[model samples]
Target: MLLKRIQPMAYHARRLYVELMFQVMGRALQAVSEVDETVRREARALPAGLLFEMMVMPDGPRLVVEHTGDGHFLYHGSQAPRAVDLSIQFKHIAHAFLVLSFREKTAVAFANDRMLVDGEISQAVRMTRVLNRLESFILPKLVAQRAVKEYPKELRLPEKLLSAARIYLRIVTHLFQTARTS
Candidate 1:
C-alpha cells in the first residue's frame, strides 16, 4: 500500500540524515578539541586512549571517538573499535534523528529513555560537557540554546561565528580528504 511504501522511505531518509549528522559531530568534536581550549581541557580530563561511540541501535550508523594522550580527539568513523570505553546507543533511528536534528536536547532524550549509556557515570558526564561545549561553538545562538541545556554566556556572537566557521572548514576538509582516499 502507499502508506507502507512511504513508511519505509521515511525510515531510510531518517537513517541517512542520522548518519550524516554523526559524521559531522564526530569531525566537529575532533576539530574543536584541537582549536578550543575548553574542549582541549575536557578532552584532557578523559582517560588517555579512551574510546567512545554513539550509535543507533540495530544496524544504524555510528561514530567512534578516541582521546589521544595529549588532549586531542580522533574521529574513528563508524567502525567501532574492539573495545569501546563508552557506548551511547539510541533506542531507534527516530530517536537519533530527533536529537541530531536538534528537535530534542540530548538530556531530554536521555530522560525520556531514548538512549542507553553503557559506561561509567563520571565519564559520561565529562563527555556530555564536551558535547555541550562543541554544540555551543558550532551551532547558532538560537539553535544552540535549544539544543543544549544551558548556552554559555561567555560565547559572544562574533566568537561563535568564527569558531563555527573554523569547525566547518575542518569538517569539509576532512570529508574531502576521506573521499579522495576512499
Candidate 2:
C-alpha cells in the first residue's frame, strides 16, 4: 500500500521534470539558430516536415521539433500528435536529465548506452552534428569543449564578439519572455 501510494507521485514528478527539460532545450535551440548562421545553414539541410524528438521511455514527457523550412524548425510542445522521423530515448529520468542538462555530451552518452536512437543512422548523425554546433555557441567554452568533437576555430576576433553579443541578447530576451508568461 505504501509503495503504491508513492509510485503515482513519483511518476508525476518525473513527468513534470521532463517537460521542463524539453522546454528549456527547445528555447535554447531557437535562440541559437536565430543568432548563428552556421546553425541556420545546417537546419536547412534537414528535410522539410521531418520530426525529431528526445524523451524518456514509455510515455514520459517528450519534446517535439518539426523542420518547417530551410534553416527553420518549430518546437511543437510535448507529445504532439505526429510521426517522428527520429526519436532518441533515455533509459530513465536521470539519463534524460543528464544528457539534456549538458553535463553529458551526446556522443559520450550514446556511446555509453545511456540513450537509444530510433530511425535512420544518417539522420541521427546529421542531427548530432547540428546539435554539436549549437552547443558550441550556447554553452560556455569550458563546458562546450567536452560537448563537441572539434570546436570551430576560424571565428575572427570581430566575428566572435558579434556572435557572442547576438547570442546573449537573444537568450536574455527569450528568458524574459518565458518568465513573464510562466
Q: Which candidate tops TM-score?
A: 1
For residues 1-182, write the lDDT of model 1, one tens digit per residue.
99989999999999999999998899998888877888887778789999989999977899999998677999999986678999899999999999999999999999999999999878887898899999999887899888998999999988888888988888888888889999
Model 2 has an lDDT value of 0.76
Model 1 misplaced regions, further than 4 Å: none
Which 10 consecutive residues of model 2 have the lowest summed lDDT? 155-164
Instruction: Write down the TM-score of every candidate.
Output: 0.95, 0.76
lDDT of each: 0.90, 0.76
Residue-level lDDT tens digits of model 2 in 1-182: 99999988886776677788687666666666677778778888788888989788877778887777777666677765678999988888777766766677888888889889999888778777777776676567777777787777875547756776776687578778867998
